[model samples]
Target: MILLLLLLLPAPALSAPGRTRATIPGDVPVVVEANHLLRKGEGTLVASGAVLVTRGNDTLRAHQAWYDPRSGELRAEGGETEARVMARVDEGEGPLAIEAGQVTRLGSGRLRASGAVHLTRGQDTLQAHEAEYDPASGEVQAWGGESRARVTARLAGETPLTVEAGRVTRVAAGVVRAFEGVVVTSDEETLRAEQAEYDPQGGELTATGAVTLEAPQGRVQGERVVYNLRTRVIAGGEVAAAVPAPDPEADVTYHLRGQSIRGAWKGEPGSGLPQEIVLERGRFTTCESPRPHFSVDAREIVLRPGQRVVGKGVGVSLFGTRLLTLPRIAVDLSGEKDAPGLFPRLSLGQPDTVGLRSDWRGTLPLGGAASGYAVLSARHLFRIGAGIDRFGSVPFGLRAGYKEEASSRFVSGLTLTVLPAFTFYLPAAWSPDGPLQVGLERMPPSARLYSGDIEGERWAPGRRYRLIASGCAGRFSEHPTEVTANRLSFSGALEVRPFGVLPRVQVGGALRGRVGYYSTGTRYGVVSPELSLYWEPSRRDRLRLDWRHQIARGTTPFFFDRIDAERSLVLEWRNRTPRRALALKAELDADNGGLYAWEIGYSRRLECLQPGIVLSQRGGDFGIGFTLEIPGLSTGF
Candidate 1:
């Protein structure tokens, strides 16, 4: 009961194993008994018996007890039995067993237990003849055992991140401050220090006084360190670090003995490899001798971890001989990628037969999360007819776009494009073969377009229902003809998600009403309804099928344009998680006279670039194309 009361109090969820062996209802009546009972008349109630208190997953037992509620004091005495006074508290992973010959509680939070006092939580154990505890602050102090105080804890992770210390303090919930001869260890790493403090919740650790951390990648010894567990960012002073080459076969560890080091490391999440790092006021070398055969004394050195070693204000020595000097240089440590700079693209028949296009792309982060992003790209296709006289912009020019979303509820986007199209003809002098083809030419002019959209979605009462409203507007203009037009469209949709109707299956359907109007006074109304079903065929494969039907009504001349109702069924399937991902999509029963189209694509992701192949068929046209994703900010080669 005492253990349950302590857990029920505001504290971290350190419950042992989360199982209630035997429980007593809190609202039930309580009966106290003993061979002899006495009341001090005004203050204390004393009883003697084989006492037992139980609540939920916690229990306390003793041979005798006394309580002074007005003074907020409780005491329990143990007789010469096999089990003395003890309290067992269960936390999800295991039970904490605390015992003492005599136990005393002051107020609601303070406790003093003496005579062979011991505490055990999970695999960790602490022993002391005397101990004091403050439950509100999770502070514990102990002395006795004819020796000194000590603490040990098991850290659960990919490896065993356990620690042992001469003395430990719960500085605060989720935080532990330990002193005197502390040793932290894991399967692949170990850190020995004189003192250390750590926050288990944040995975942050700080240590001081002759600290040395060793792992598979390298080793570091320093006077102090502040390391973030999640980000793998570390800052240490009076530091000596050994960074290994990305390739193990190199059999060389680069040593950076420096005054300080700061960097955000990159490994496979928790692999403990420093993918990136930086050091200040250091001497770096590849030699493993007691004294480096040669080293570079630098003001700063940045490790593009595994990729390159960049240095500034660097001086090199060959066996203590001042051999060379470099103001700045970046040594290549890794190979190249389809980079972010200008890349020459070759297409078989895009804008023309065997066309060459120059493409440049870049991406930048606007802020936090995945939504605030701005991407810019420019591409120019080089095509030829003979005797080109006019100097004009190339085909498919430039685009700048940005998008942001507030989670899944609201989204906003804007994009501007420089779209180019031209028809070419040979001049009289250029058409040497025939005069009939001299004047045959068609020019459609150039155009630019801008578009924006805003959307908001909300759930109605139950999670199965959703309401969405969105609006979009766009404008385009022809340069030479000065012909301009604008369009605006708004839609409202109600979605029904009855996903769990079948096990391991998800299904949804929605009805949408849309209205679109153009600046030229042309208007269209659409009644579109869609139904979709998705199933997980395997642990790593998914298939989705959808049926979409649209009813469109508008006025138009048959000779100018024909407005037809459209209905289509689409199906898509993909692998859930793979080194290389593949997807297939098919559309059936479409608007342009009952035709079907589909596409299949495969993609492979690299650190700097992703390459893809797409095979698509639309109506009667089929195409197979190769593409490269070079749209992100470079991680500096």
Candidate 2:
């Protein structure tokens, strides 16, 4: 039985230790053992029992190793300790070594390692849970369940730099490829990604798939990110980051989803270079308010500190609600909260005893350096109809002025105003007295007037002292007529405050002179002057005293020389409770002479109520009135 004999016969004698079984044309020997053979013609070799092969500096070892001479590849299989191999050909003092439990060489200088592959070249070391390495091209790939690898290199200063990854591969001398939950941390920052590549020679790193960068300035999140360490530049896609400001009040958090984001370092220590951020197509939202108070969407946007932003196809919203949409929008980065001022107000109300009234006022900017501005306002009142009688009137007017700011003073443009009025009054026999008629008759029936005025004030450059001067002239009509009576008025005031004073001391005087000539042959002249002194010892206490004298003379029996004089003193005190939950104020007024009058009132305010309450007594006409007001609902006349 020839087959039995072939199986039982001893294998051909393998080459002895340190012996050559086959030699190449250049004296390059191929070695094998008793159970191993190198068949160049058959393109295969088999080795067993701690097999060892050498070619110059290249060495291979394994319990069992195989080679295909036709393909010029080698493989080893056995316990990793025995499967280790070193490959080099007089390149240097040391050779590159590859060790794994099982190694397969697939020609083309490529080797795949499974079960704890480790690569080491001099002081450089790479350990992968598993890997594939090509010595000829310096390409290595490692991946497996929960795979990870670490690489370390000693720099010129003997400082060791290390990199760790879940999966790693070397593509070239300075480039390494990594994937599947990768993280790279260097001396300056840390980066995480689903995939990434690093090149130490180029000083560049790129990442994708949920990439995130963490640095001292901020944290950046994006889909893709690339960073250049040498230039200190970082570029990203669909990035979002948090930037904090130096001022606590000026700090703002922004959300930006854009085409890309880039940052560079200024080279100066601790100085983050000003960033130039471009959003090709993106939007921004702020985290401030009852809702997101501000938001803008644009086709393109650029951001730089202290620079205005101009956006196209812009949409802006406040409090989470769209407020405006524009083809273009620009915003100043350094503008004050209320710098560009425009205020308009409208109100309607009915005082318990005064009937119904409405008022409107608004301010407009005139656009100039002189602080030119205009004000337009109007008011209407409808007296409650009683006993089949109704009375109502409307008054409207406009005033424009220019203001200039000087060293320590402000001057106002001369202003002119005209107001026409209409009214109805029943004879004294109609109604002796009623709540509605008590204070209504004091209003003029009808009037037309014109006036010119100049007002100027100077506030001490660094102190609380002020001086004011004002004057005006106008005409009035008791009834509609082609010609109307005229009036002249003037006033002056001065305020002084000593150092460490809580309130200023104010002294002022006013003068009014009127000369009227009617087309109906009626003439009258009147002059009135008032002197006043006011002192506020503190925010809660005040005192005022005034004296007025009036002289009226008429040219006809229908009129007469009427002389009236009055002197009054007033005192007020206000205080807030220690708890700050309640406030109280009291006032006393006394007048003597032709218009002798005395009044005392007190008011208490509570935070929960509309405002507060007042109780007053004046001579024999004492009464109590309460008022509740909301900004847009109250009317004052």
Candidate 3:
């Protein structure tokens, strides 16, 4: 049977003495082990069990092996043997190894490892005390001690990816450079670097010197920092810094120092969306007074996500007083409230006898309601007078006034008279809700009279009630017998709010009648009755009381059957006190045949000083007067 099947087939494969076995070139059958054979020069190989090596798609395994075909050294050792090394340039499932002690093949496609160096790819795990590998540019370089170089990456559903560096460098393919204290964690941001560079094929992350960029919308301090995980951009450089959320009345403390700073993370996905800062050469100030009310300067500045600052060279001040100089300035973390305006004034005073007096007032904004108000005025009453010296014959007088209210419903009016004459007011219409009035007159036919009047008022349906009326007619052209005198006056009033729990209390009464017919017999008749009382407790207190009564009957020539009766009483008061303390005005008059008069006044305020008093008894000649007031020389309107 062919020599007994060649003695059971297995005894002719043993060559030991100057040992040699080498055949590693492809298709899975590789074995390289030698004892001493110096094939081309010198050699040493000692392989004990299971040592296999393949080339093209690289596979290497060993138990105990040593080979030196004259320094193309390959060494592997194992007490618990397990080594598998493979390479296919580097993608998934390539370039991996386990339990490597010493393997040296240095010829440009370098590879060198000292003691325990384990490297794996595809679920990546790299541990090294020392390793330097380059299988034709699929680089790996690591250093150890102080917690010996460790790298781990699991990726895909992400949780493992970690790196700690004391020193690590793989400069080219898929670049990485870390030194000193560098740490990179990957479950969405945790990086600290004294120097870090990682470019997993340009999915970029670069950091320099003292850089720190923590995530969760917060810290970024830098000398250099750049991160771009596929265009999710973040950049920083210089002494670039950022701090948001700390305002104690913020007088310049919303920080972002910059030579450069750029950040963006918009919309959807965990919605903490708060990074949209773009600043370069920017500055901001909130002004807590030692001379700053507002400040901002920018070549560029745009910060969103509620710290909302959009700026470009803007400056504003108040208290440190410099009102607005802006190129552009916008700040609204959305708490909107703004109030400004009212720093205009001019005045000079001496309010009675009207000598050396000047007044001008201003306040505006009626329709847009910033408290809805309007007022403007001009007054120069230097010597307003009335004089009469009976038998010795002399007469004198003067008056001037100009007032304007440009929009609490329009009024620009003027009144001027000299010697009981001249009067003028062409524009009229005043409104506390439309109470229209008009008047015109001209008289000089030796002081007779010619007149015109129109008035209106309507507030009947709960506008607190009002119905007042007036119609006057006059024509008296000097009658020395061509006799002319036609006068008519009609009036009505009923405006009552008698104290329905006193909303400033007001009581009113008025009835007036007048008629005259003369062709020389001088026929005339008059009846006047008036009573008024009003009290406003606040809005700067005011009180008033007035009573008037007059009855007249006439014929002509030193009285043929003429009788006259007059009675009057008037009292008024006004008050305002506290810083702008002004309580000015007093007038008391009583007449019926008793004749009494009293006048007291004060006007200067704002560091107040005032005194004024006057008492007069006309028929028997009695008088008293005193006046002195200085409110820092009063000037305001």
| TM-scores for the candidates | 0.42, 0.44, 0.26
**Clash count of each predicted structure:** 10, 2, 1
Task: List where candidate 2 sits over 4 angstroms from the true fold.
Answer: 1-53, 60-73, 76-108, 121-125, 145-166, 199-202, 246-252, 263-272, 288-291, 305-314, 324-637
| Clash count, candidate 3 | 1
lDDT of 3: 0.44
Winner on lDDT between 1 and 2 is 1
Ranking by TM-score: 2, 1, 3
Residue 602 Cα positional deviation in candidate 2, in Å, after optimal superposition: 28
Greater TM-score among 1 and 2 belongs to 2
The sequence of per-residue lDDT tens digits that candidate 1 reaches over residues 408-427 is 10111111222221222122
Candidate 2 residue-wise lDDT, 218-256, digit = tens: 566888988876666778878765443323343334445
Task: Residues 553-607, candidate 3: write the lDDT tens digits.
Answer: 6653212112222666667676544223333333233443433444343433322
Best of the two (1, 3) by lDDT = 1
Error of 2 at 466 (Å): 25
